[model samples]
Target: MKKVLAGLGAALLLFVVGLAVYVASRQHLKFSVPLPAVAAATDPAVVERGRYVVRNLASCPICHGDPKQMERAQAGEEVPLSGGFEFNIPPGKFYPSNITPDPETGIGRFSDGEIARAALRRGA
Candidate 1:
């Protein structure tokens, strides 16, 4: 009985170690995307068009915050985009990133390309 228990314990330990090694080996996984060489749009018309696309065409407001805050934002109020919204799903809990322009707590330091990559391909 003692030997059987010892063997079972050893097997469990080996399994855990193997799993850890497998996961660690996968940390360097990479995904590639072909991003075109594009400069920031400085044109007022283009800027306004992009803003309109995000605010009206896309569901950015609904995904970013509660309805009340979205309404205020739609009413031309300055609403911070600091995201800490949590979603509990069957897979796990996920906290959406804070996308505010705040340098400390948001994506202020990230380049536009980096932000685009994250938004488009979940890469950063």
Candidate 2:
């Protein structure tokens, strides 16, 4: 019984230490990016081009898109992006961020610089 208790205690200590080290390493890996002065373009042509890129090239519409509209988008028809797609993968379950103009649930709350950096993944 004494030997078993000692072994269990040692294992618990090792797990705690390992978890701390993993957390510390992740914190060190975080990098800060300077926000740029640019804002999302408002030109109609640029807007349409961005939509085209997201729908076709990057295929973001197939993932970070409205669930109800996914069928249309998948069928090669352009659908409005209202990001709320979800998936589970390593680390955790995740949902694509809302990109619509809604102030409460979308990019409307974020500054232009933040949006630009996030979109370009400046630090990531």
Using TM-score as the measure, which candidate wins? Answer: 2
Which digits, one per residue and each the tens of the lDDT, describe model 1 over residues 24-112?
99989976876545556899999999778866777565556544476688787656666656788867887667777778988888677
Model 2 local distance difference test score: 0.79
Q: What lDDT score belongs to each candidate, Candidate 1 first?
A: 0.72, 0.79
lDDT of 1: 0.72
Candidate 2 local lDDT, 16-122, one digit each (tens): 99999999888857566788898778999999998778767887676668888877877888766677677889888887877776789877888888877887667
Worst 10 residues of 1 by lDDT: 59-68
Task: Please list the residue runs of candidate 2 whose C-alpha ends up more than 4 Å from where it truly belongs after superposition.
Answer: 1-31
Candidate 1: the clashing residue pairs are none
Query: What TM-score fits each model?
Result: 0.61, 0.66
Error of 1 at 117 (Å): 0.9
